[model samples]
Target: MHILLHDFAGHPFQAELSRVLARRGHRVTHAWFAGDTGPKGRMARTEGDADTLAFLPAGQDLRYSKTDFLRRRAGDIAYGQELGQAICAMKPDVVISGNTPTEAQEGIQRACRQTGTPFIYWCQDFYSVAASRLLARKLPGPGHLIGGYYRFLERRQMRRASRVLHITESFRAQTDAWGIPRERVSVIPNWGALDEIGVLDRNTAWAQANGLGPGTRFLYSGTLAMKHNPELLAGLARAVTAGDQVVLVSAGVGADGLAARAADGTLPGMRVLPLQPFEVFPQVLASGDILLAVIEREAGTFSVPSKILSYLCAGRPIVLAAPGDNLAAQILRETGAGQVVEPEDTEGFAAAAQAFRDDPAARQAAGAAGRAYAEAHFDLERVADKFETLFSEARNGL
Candidate 1:
């Protein structure tokens, strides 16, 4: 089968999905905005023919560039037309859209209609709710307007999709609210690279090279956006009085403020390091004694953080700061691999950190459990099989 994977707001997970599907003996091609810089692994040939202009930032926090913003809304129309052309040319058997923007949604839908192919919505995020809430929280006036428009597009897109693969049950529930048939939606959680499980010793080598001393390292990798709550992260920095050192190696956009604040504080044994290369990410994650999943209380407490999958695969104990009902928290509790604390509960997070630091056996047990859960449930090969089954069913109209 030939597959065209599209995501206007480019994400690494989309690329991962393409790889999984392709490895299962399907031809895959990726269509993304020109400047979206997520990883594109061996899944398929990447073609930057997708309809939206990229909004990439100049520096580390990687904010959307002004050029991208000025061109995005209008370019989306062009994007849709071009996407339609691509579909006509490729004539793929299945079309998958990964969290598309408004313009791409309409474009991809048109392409699917014209090509007479089964369409799948690989839901990485609830675009309608997530994007609207994100914009409303960050940019009120124009953001709210755009968000409302995006929500409208989201409903239309969901209606047109032949199948929807949600990241969690809660995410799938959102689609059910729209009166889409429940059978059309299935739960497929984000997966970790199963190939990464064998690299434990590499973590030591990476730490030595990076000057991260041999001690209990608690890591919080990824972005530090507004939804990430800088103040709480700062509090955790200040609260780490345990003998075990606290080192934060941040990568991706949005960590300058946290880094600046961490520097000014007189917290002993705390170091904020720069983001490492992707090659070393697995090792970096493995080297850590514990992983901290930080989401602001206001960023909607129920959303699952992608970092959890990586942390689980790395075999680390997690201290997740989010609502208890969130899918991530539920999974952590179910597997006995981590503990969840309220996003704003500094004392609770601090206490949890201290307990892990004090109890090596407990930390090891949690790490082992996390690794086992990741291998059994979050393996890429296993996830690929799930997708194959779904794709086969969608193709057969089952």
Candidate 2:
């Protein structure tokens, strides 16, 4: 079978999935937008048996610019059209679209319908909910109108999909209301690329080289967007005792915010660094005494932070601030691999971090438990097998 997977955000896991499917005797094409600035810089294409296609030209980074919102929206529409044309040209046996903008998804759905191709909606997050939240803050009166428009588009795409692969069980309720049958929806949570990440000692060379050994490092790695609560790190820094030696390290947007705060003498003991390369991810992850994950209360239900899965692979105790009902928080509670606090509870977040910092034995135990859970549920091969079966089923109209 010829399989095509598209993730607008250019997630490495999607690329890994293409490789996994290729290894399983299927021709796979993983497609993504070139504008996305991941850990690795933009590439027109990647060399592999499973062809990697990057649509759009390089140097189109517009994700963080509020002034370019309208321009970005127009770009999204153009990119969608381009992606639709590419899909039509490829004419793969099956297409799986994940983490796509509603506009792009609609384009793909239309293209699939026109070409008579079976495709699955690999929904990692609901864009309509996010759009509503973001636009409500930016443009109060017209936000609802625009959000409703996207929701309508999303419903159409969801209804037309041959299968809907939801990352969380909570997503099924909304799609079910669209009259999508339960049989057509499957909850296949996201997984980490365990082959690329391994458990390493905190005293590894990377840790020592980065000056991470002397202090209790609390690291937050990955994109820190509107969905994250930046104040959580600020409050944690302010609350830690003088002798605690608790340092906060951030790599993405959060790092930029924290670095600015540190410059202004507001956030003490915070170190900001650029995102590490994928090759040294394991070592970078291992340098931390504890990993931090935060989600805004409103966004928690619509999205699960994939960083939590990667943190699990690093064998570190995680401290997550999210709604109690969030899938990420629920997993932590069930596995006992980390601590979950309400998004607004700064004191609880700080106390959890301090507890892990003070007690090495407890931290080690939690880290071990997290690794065990990752081994069981987050192995890349296991996740790929599930996707392979789903793709085959969709292709065969099963």
| Model 1 spans > 4 angstroms off | 7-17, 31-63, 66-88, 102-104, 138-145, 199-203, 242-245, 251-253, 263-270, 396-398
lDDT of 1 by residue, 179-291 (tens): 77888888787776656434385247777887776666777876565466655556667776555556677643446765665577665556777756556777778777888
- Can you give the TM-score per candidate against the true fold? 0.81, 0.90
lDDT of 2: 0.77
Instruction: Count clashing residue pairs in model 2.
Output: 0
TM-score of 1: 0.81
Best by TM-score: 2
lDDT of candidate 2 at residue 150, scale 0 to 100: 86
lDDT of 2 by residue, 46-110 (tens): 45543433233322443433236677677677677777887788798998998887876887888
